[model samples]
Target: MRRMLIVDDEPLIADGLYTFFAKADIEDMEILKVYSAKQALEWLDTVKVDIVLSDICMPGMDGMQLIQEIVDRWPRCKVILLTGHNEFEYAHQAIRNPCVADYLLKTEGMEKIRETVEQTLKQIARENDFRYQAEWFQEKMPKALPQLQRQLLLDLLKRRGAKAWMNLQEEFDAIRLPFRAELAVLPMLLRIEEWGSYESQSDQRLLCYAAANIAEELLGDKAAVKVAELDSRSLVCYIQPHAGQLQQHGLEQGWERTIRFVMGTLESIQQSCRDCLRLSVSIIAANQAVQWGGLQQSVNRLGLAVFDSPGHGMEKLMRLDITGETAGLSLRQDKLAAAELLLEHMKQRLLEGSDDWMCSFRQWVEITGEGGPDDPFLRLRLLHGIADVSLRTVQEAGLSEEAGREHDLAPMLHFNIHTRWSDIIAFYRETCQWIVLRRRDSCRLDESHILMNIHHYIKQHLDGDLSLTRIAQEVSLNPSYLSRWYKKVTGRGISDYILERRVEKSKELLLGTTLRMQDISGQLGFSDQHYFFRFFKKAVGCTPQEYRDQRKGAAETKM
Candidate 1:
């Protein structure tokens, strides 16, 4: 249902309009009335008003100002300015605001006003329909085929245990994977070590796709290779022996030959990336092949190995020797794999501004602490990843200088100084906590600065043009956005603030000086003495002379 509010300072006119709307044959509309813009706003605080009919000149916060308040509160609400004054400037200004449907003089009959309101309702309905149609179109559109395939591979790699692979073949066939579920596969993890000048996410993704294409081109003849980019920097390729080669050379010989060819082709892939793309990457291949059920474990181990290795400045081509690492896969290795995955998850959360990343970090620390002794390489990797994200956040938020002064930020950059695992964890937590707090402080400071600028401008221009549009221009913000932001931050409408300031200034002038009423009204930016008198009486509950005389009588009594 739609709601309409009629605002006019005069009681007869406000009631008359309400009675006319209530008796009219308008459908689905709840009509209300208020005596002033301030009362209208107070009603608007709780009720969702769909249309407002207001006088362009009121005692406090006139119709022009009310338009901004309505825009801030109920953006879709239409306003019709009603005034006795037939000024072209007033109509032009009202027409400029998108929410203002019409500027009808009170001389225009009730029929014209009601017709304008009905038209506004239709406009609102059309806008709502367009929004719904746009949303429907978005929902019905299909995602890209490559994105679906990548997501499937990522899900498969993260799945655990044998039960998870029950429907693996059907899922693979859905995305047209070349290999069957029964065949053993080799998983190779690739990490892009350096992108040189390609820093943006889109550029890096293009490089990753190009690099994968180069790998497929080099090793496509020997094995069935399918690559899925796991993140911006890492990709995993699943390789299986081609059916023709396996049938011709036997399973064991063909599989062994395919593995050798893959290993040999890594050098060529690396060279191609360097020569053509000018990018450096690190590659880690599993020492032995695994079935679909064991693929997750092999990929996890390789992920940890690739991430833990020191590949900061150079490309690394290494084989993950899972067989040689302790007799069987140990608990420590599993914990390390879990930790690596958690860190990656935390990185994403940190970028998205979620506090859950801190919880993930704490869980990683607890897992690391419970895993008996710590690996130096694991500690170094954690430190590097955490410090990188922390510093990047600080820099992006423009808090680097403050962070440097508040804590020992230098140690975060140099991981060699932290000798103990506990020291590393403690320092990282401290840095993260500081970053979170400082970011909040910086946001508060920014908000305070904006409010200060707005308040300053309002105070400075009290006698000049204090219209919402002029105030918005002074603050360098859209009038609607400025009104919304101010109300949200200060918990009061900007119009209310302006009214309060004007009242306070009037009181000061009445008590402190003997300025003539007309001069005082002009100085306060009122249209005339009569408007100022009504404004002061409405706010102070007394005329200007009465207020001054009451204060003088009280002062004389005190003396």
Candidate 2:
């Protein structure tokens, strides 16, 4: 509802306007009367006033001064000036202030005043509509721009041939990319070697994005830098020296210095990622810059170098000369890729509450055990991957303590502790089975705990704010989801449960206490006694007083 304040130094005028508006039947509008500018300012301090009608010549603070205060406090509130003097200067000043709706002589009848107030309300509504649309576009543009830039970069990364690079400068400009087209750029690939506590794909992507931000922050001053996530676990950064830097140091020396600075900053970036995000990353950068046309080949070379590097879960920084042959890298890459796929599939199945993940684990073990001598590096990679999945699953399910007590599998993650492949495989199999069983028990316990918390909060706050939004906040859940889930779990709606509780409380108060109807209704959170009486009669098939009398009579007869 909109509130309008009527302020005049004279009591007669203020009270008359208030009485007229109170009886005028202005829908959804509340009129308040104040005798002076001081009283009006006090009211505005605590309440929102939509329109202010005040006399132009008051004693201490004139209507013009009050308008300025209102502008500062509530910029949306419209002010109308009324005065006995029909002075031209007052009208001119009122017209200059945007907050002043109209300047009028006191001789303008209350009807004219009422019409002006109604028009001011319509003006407020129109302004609110325009503001909402502008706010929506402002909110959406920031979120949309990033996705557009990412898609453009991905397209450029995959495009081939000179024709693909024809409009490269225009595409970059459209997205506001910092790097200049046709300039030699330094390309670096960042791979998350170990995802400490992050398990979900979304969480992993967030960490990768944070890592990219850290890269930009550290190296942005030296070069024009743009970083984009290639996947959940990796992102690529393209860096080019700014024009001024290139002119000062010549083209060759400028790129050399920028590349050197980037290489030196990698350690700092890695430290920030480790400290802030708890992620270990491996960075591979080219020792020399590559032309825009050859960016994809350079990125590919860095990817192969990462795949061939040993010690899968440790952080490392490698500089590629961009001229090595990746002949023998394919075989190892295939093996690692297969192992990663199998582990991811098993993780998904386990989270879905299935026993078939054990089958996938067995297949992975077979893949690791296949053919041509024992590659300890490959086994080490598989061991760390499985251990990570198992530990994260146990932690996410809140069964870490139980898993620790039941099995001492922590040492299985260490390569030296379980050097034998057979021993590692046996431990891995036992961990998988333990996860399946414990997860089932954890699910039941989690549901029970959630229901208990929700019910307890509802009971304690029966007379307070027990809205769906409040209850969801109490139990840390989304309001809409909680409503649907609670109904599905209890076979009754939450609102129905609340109504039943209120009725039970009302009955208890009626039969057990000598409280008045108003007191009982207030205690039970009803707005008034009449609403309470109607609600109680509809629910219990009798009015509250009638139900109380009948129950008491039945008890007296029994005695």
Candidate 3:
């Protein structure tokens, strides 16, 4: 069955079209009715509709924008537009875009609408057949080498199984990567830094490709290297440590020697990259060698290092442990700069509400409480570092504007240190949570203010147009955006509230007025007495004269 969604802002018009299509003889068609383009887009997000017949003049997201979204999201779904004569020019511009099968002037009547729908359905049916046939042959195509290489690496990294390894070895031999099997390798992470400083590089992917080629050439003499760009700023270079360089007793005999050689090659890699690419590169050398089974751990550990120690980014060679700890807490001038740099990184992560920051927070608390330097002054310094990060996080998150909270770290500064580790950790958690609560309360207050302004404007402008466009301008918002926000705040469209108010006002005028029906209609901004009468009858179950007569009869009887 083909599904059709009809969207229009007029409740009667939208419902009328839904009822008309439900009764149409267009095969086994399923029909849905939504009052605005915003609602139609929400429906599209959850369900795929075969055809969309949308009015181009609704308040939220007009038909042209609606069709554009439909074409972008469900390119196969056909759209037929229904627009008023005044909007036909706007609709014509949209007609030039794809996925719009046709548009009809609403005055063209229901017969034309039925005909257009039938034609669009025939096209959709033929397109589906073509798609099915095309996909059947396309599935039989061969896979490419780049895809095979990535899959092989993933399987090895995951340590899939013994048979998987055998398959990988066969694939490796076929690709002629004999250097890969030559034993122990180190996972040294390379992060491209100051990339924004490069004026000539416009394409980041091409630059990364060039960097990988450069690394291969620089390390060619000392090591067999495989480099992969990990993300926008990071890369992974698996260096196969030359066998002759490792001492005979599994590297125990020359651990320092291995470190020296690796550092020299890293300096060469960094300097060569600067000379050739005009880009700075930072390398984080792991403390030990790792095989395929441990690759994931290496990635996570290194990823945390880059995040937790953003200051160490310039240090050329950083030896990172899994604890996310720096060697000293500003124990010297260099260490103090490192500490400040690390806190700057933490402050940013806290603003982003990163769960990784939370994990690092917990680990830092535990590590410092148990294994930090025994000196009292050092432990106090560590406490101050943690406090600095939290205080800055609250400031950046804008706590001062909400709940009128003071943006000061005096409480954290005056907090008394205790011997118990739990006491210290508890204090940190309590302060962070308090700021978060204050910020949320302030946001709710702001939303309430916006709602009050909307209500005030509607009541003040009953004689005016009172249309969404005018009211949205009063509040400095896009009409469609205001529509969604009003609905979200009040649980119904603004039009629904306006209609209710109009009905209530008509009841009062009918009871209290002695004026002619046309005069009363003019006061309500209705187009004419006839439109006013029809609207009253639909809402009040009686014509305006009838409603007045009934009210007079009730008053006499009560007297």
Candidate 4:
């Protein structure tokens, strides 16, 4: 069943729809009834709602404002606007935004809302299917090389599984070549400029897949491409190892031509919404020899700029100029300039590199933490960014020449230095861990934080008396509120997480010590061993004795 939120200024209208949804066997649906947009936004901050049925005319914040916020922050939530007026002008403007899934007149009755919600949910499920299918294709589809080659690419980008990557490198010695390489990641930003007033979700999904297909074509053995929706207005085609040549002049010419070709192809595929289409390509380059933070950061930086640009077809390559002397205030200005320049500067620093370029790039990465917005993530991304840039820089440079000279520049590029990068990265990660812990300590909310301190308390006191009232009192929340919020946030009731934890504890005692099953059951606060057995079987798919037997048999087999 889909989770839905009904936002209407009128209590009767909200209650009517809520009651209708409940009786329709969609009652299993987690429904949030909000009398105004204010309550909706407040609840939305914590709940993972799937659909919204909101009236257009509410005090303070209207349906339009709610829709805008949903689009901005919760892009995945489908919104069906319930408006009284039938002005085509209003419909035209409201539907212009991609996040407004459907608009219905309040006079259409409760049944219409039910049908609209069902259709919206069905479409969402189908889009999720498409997403999974695309991922499956990414997993199974072969490139010009074998599975080993693809894994080698992943290993190089991630700076992991050195032995396997090395074995592959040795095995594919004919294709192996290294050059002065840096990693560049390109994420396709699909900005819908003017989605027609009656645009369907299927059309949007088609446009996204069409963009992905075009990206795969242009990228052509250069990068691994995948599609995702970054927000309401855009979809992303994440391309890894974003590296090309600055050697031959054709590299620039070819890249520009490729951009045109991709734009044209996307236009052709999404011909229906040609006027609505906009594409922004963002690239981040790092050293190819080490790991950066993660691919997600690069994708985020690239995808975030989609709405900031205009025009239907355009390409912007990130470039950096580091040959300058500055001090104090001048230094701060240059740093700000670099941050503002972002992808452009990094792109230039990658393909056009000197010793000065490397030092400047490294310094930028050290300061910004691989273009990460936060500290821990920043450091992780920096390591990843460095490896990506170095690997792709080496790979592209080598690809320009013959593949035979792979190992020639590997030593000079300090390839050995990256092998030890994991250690330094581990140290950096520890610092990030501290940072994350510190941030969590300061920034987390007390009222609706999903971390479940109450659950922790329950687990600690499970052996003693435990009841809903006692538990609610301990958490300083009403029993009813605790039950609902716990289920909503954790996808299970308090009793459920607690029961599972107790069973887990009991299993440890059963296998690791000589405790009897009855004693273990009692120790876990189960009234009877029989009841515990039933609960264990229901949750674990095995009785306590059967679990112990299976473990013992596995141990024997291992011996």
Candidate 5:
């Protein structure tokens, strides 16, 4: 009886397979079912299984990881993938991998699965036979070893191979054996990256098996490759080639073609993995006869080339400058830093009331709005910048009081400009903007229009000493939390904004009419002219009188 492990997240799919397998009359198979890749791996640690059937996608640590683990721990285990998404890459990749036994699309129904299973089992049996025959032939080949001694040696290698291989010459001399050549070893490295798709874990496992199959085919009879996964996103294959076979083949173009085929097959599988899963493939090409050090250098070069080359979807082979082994993580970090700087720059402009604020505001709006829900906060912070622009606009205009009419401020909002912040902010910023407008309307009409009510509470009594804490109380929120929330939504602190508006009103009173500085200060709720002068200097970097003088000089210069 053969042992099989079935991995899939969906109960219906798993149960369906259980029923189908039972009906197939393959009674000699004992099946274990697991819902996740992690569970499958845990089971693999202790349970010896002949075959594994896995789904492509699951909640966490998906099928690709499971397949890699199987190939690493049990190279002989046959993997059959049953996936729902139809993509030729899965089957093509599976055909390329030695570890994968078969690929069966779920849509093919139970009959096809049964057929694939039988074929896989048959193949496994044939390989086992080949291994035995190869061992036996090695023993009888007189040039290699005499038949009688060769048979004994073969048994010793299989039974206590680790110890025997470590001290082969010593053991041979002790046993009166005559083979005198030094031992040689060849190493192959295989690395796989995950598809950008969201295929079921079972399906992904099957795809991973397909990748392994490609590597297996490339090595053929000349090498033995062990499959393992580095993480959720990558797979590793270790290849040990037979020196004699490699000498006969030399460095062949067929091996290069095999690498291309593996990459192409992976591309095809990614297409089936769902549109989201993008893939990039990289392969290392080296002379099979090279020593372990040269091989390691070659593999490292290949790795750098694979990761460094820029290509979308599946890429075949990347040639590396074997002289250098540098990676590019530092470059990627610099790009991330640049993105943050750009975001912060936009926020600063929005808060400062620049006349070209609309352009910066809109850019921020578009970036965050497009960020989508998966990473909403990261992009949404951009929206907060837009809201900050709008709120600061109102505060700067000294219009936090309910507009006597909406049209009065409509032009300032610049809603029609293609790159206006208002349009970019759209629904997200509008939600908070409505809060400010509602406050203003509530005080103006003594009636609650949701848009103007909040502003009304603040304006009705300026002497009430309004702060985010007091303001948020009317809106039902904790002070600190509301302040942070407002800043996140508006890109400016509530306190800074209120001060800007108050200072602007004081400036308007001082310049537009003959009101004395003390009278203007008193009317705008400043304690005195001195206090107002210091406040104005801090905000504008000049005293009130100096600002007026500059404005007068600027007007005369313009005239």
Candidate 6:
């Protein structure tokens, strides 16, 4: 429905247009008549008008200044100026504004004015649909906020340093993490020691998601846990006990309670994965709760222990035990080789867009950085693997003008795993973020490209076959895929687009050329004139002949 405000200082003209609409065939309109521009503004303050018609010359606020005021206040409202032949000079200035739909000479009849009203309503409908879609997206984005927030927290940790920890503390409330900065946090590292064979990337990803859920679900109540599924089948949980429980016990006792809670949660998680998910997981937790200042080094030790010493079979629970010499150099080399192979497998999983690839990769980098070889030669090999994985993942993500910038690896190339721990972790995280942002952009671009191609194809082939199969072929997409994708992207079906394009083209040809209705119908790919007539009336609220006559009459009146 639409509202039309008719403003004229003259009683006769104002009442006449109001009566004109009251008696007209227009169904969805609230026709209003106001005696003066001031009265129209008063009514506008109370109600929003979709269309405003006012005479150029009034008492205090003339139509020129009145239209300007209405435009600023109700920017969406379309305005039309009515002027006598002498007052037609005002049309020159008023018509310059985008808000001024068109101006009519008072000498022109009211039916001509009603045609303008119908056209404006069509535009308002489009604007309202767009606004509704924008509002809908705003309403839905909050649901994804938790996932995004957790990802941000994990990214912050990868950067390390006091600055990153401080930043994480600041964001705890915003991301709705279930913890406070002052509470004791028990960081638990969960490693999937075995999960049988995995071939498909989708399967690999689903298993990771399943594992993360099992861990979070078991540990969700007393603690605020942020889990990152890192590479090589490890899950890192940043756990903070509820503030109320921590406050009652004081820092020391609360810390002890958190450790016990975390241990119990890990054991439950292991059992759940085995029973419910049918997989084996090893858990390594930080021995003592450390404040944000020493959180990086503390969690690093746990990550290493979880990956290096994943126990055999069901006996997969322990604490950080990496504060010892290696068993033997050759044995360590063999373990590292196995780790490197697992990392390569994870890299493939991520490229496949597996569910928790990013989390898994970060876990791999963090844990492996600890247990990884200290010898410069062996460490260099590990760094190279990390660099290769990072670069390849970034490319798959499509994050930059040139996604495969191996130059980013040049810095890691000169560095090793042991001494440059912080630098490598930071690089890994930065790369992950870059990958995520770019991949999102790529997906959006892909959607936009499909829509643009479909639209262009429809417009260019208005007279040709405009079937879904034809349009899809032109765009090199499957017809069914294109149909759903086009509707999803544009909020309307491909056939709807074709019909709209045909109608718009018919209008242009109707007004611009003296084409016969049959010829025009044929050119628009319509089978016959009657079908075109019904379609034009249904879509435009007027028959094609009525629309053309109105345009012709308006042109002659202007002349």
User: Which candidate leads the pack in TM-score?
Assistant: 1
- Tens digits of per-residue lDDT, candidate 1, 1-559, equal 5678899998768867776886684765667777899989987886678889999999879999999999999988899899897999998898789999889989988898888888888987887796767776555534555677778877876665578889888987766677878888999988898999988989998999999888878889888888899888888998988988899999899899999999988888899999999999888898778887777777777877765667454799988786685314444467666676777666556544567778778878887773324566656655665666667667776877787688778876555534666677778777767766666667787778888987888777777656555576676786667767888988997768988989988888888999988878877876457768877998889999999999999999999
- Could you tell me which 10 consecutive residues in candidate 5 have the lowest summed lDDT? 329-338
lDDT of 2 by residue, 250-312 (tens): 988988888888989999889999999998989988888888877766777788788677876
**Model 4: per-residue lDDT, tens digit, 1-559?**
3568889988667767765775575533556677888888876785567888899889999888888888766788898999888968768878897767898998888788788988888788887796757877565654533334434433342332235343433543433322112333343444545544427878766665555455555555543344444445555454443234333434445345444444444434344334334433332221121222333333334333332335433433331111222112133333333443342344344444322343444445455543333334334444455445444543543332432332232332442323344444344333223333433443345544444667677778877645554576677776567678778777887666767788789889879988888898878876457767876887789999999999989999999
TM-score for each predicted model, relative to the true structure? 0.50, 0.48, 0.49, 0.29, 0.26, 0.40
Show the lowest summed lDDT stretch of 10 residues, model 2.
Answer: 325-334
Residue 36 error, candidate 3, Å: 22
Shift in Å, residue 347, candidate 1 = 7.9
Candidate with maximal lDDT: 2
Candidate 3 per-residue lDDT over residues 77-148, each given as its tens digit:
988888777565786686687788898888898889989999999888887785666775455433454445
On a 0 to 1 TM-score scale, where does candidate 3 land against the true structure?
0.49
Model 1's alpha-carbon lDDT is 0.79
Q: Score residue 263 of candidate 2 by CA lDDT.
A: 89
Model 5 segments more than 4 A misplaced: 23-27, 88-92, 130-132, 139-559
lDDT scores of the candidates, listed in order: 0.79, 0.80, 0.68, 0.56, 0.54, 0.70
Q: Order the numbered candidates by TM-score, best leading.
A: 1, 3, 2, 6, 4, 5
Give the Å shift of residue 369 in candidate 5: 99
- The true-versus-predicted C-alpha distance at residue 529 of model 5, in Å, is 81
Over 4 Å off, model 4:
131-559
Residue 38 lDDT in candidate 5? 82
Q: Each prediction's Cα RMSD?
A: 11.7, 13.5, 11.8, 22.8, 32.7, 17.6
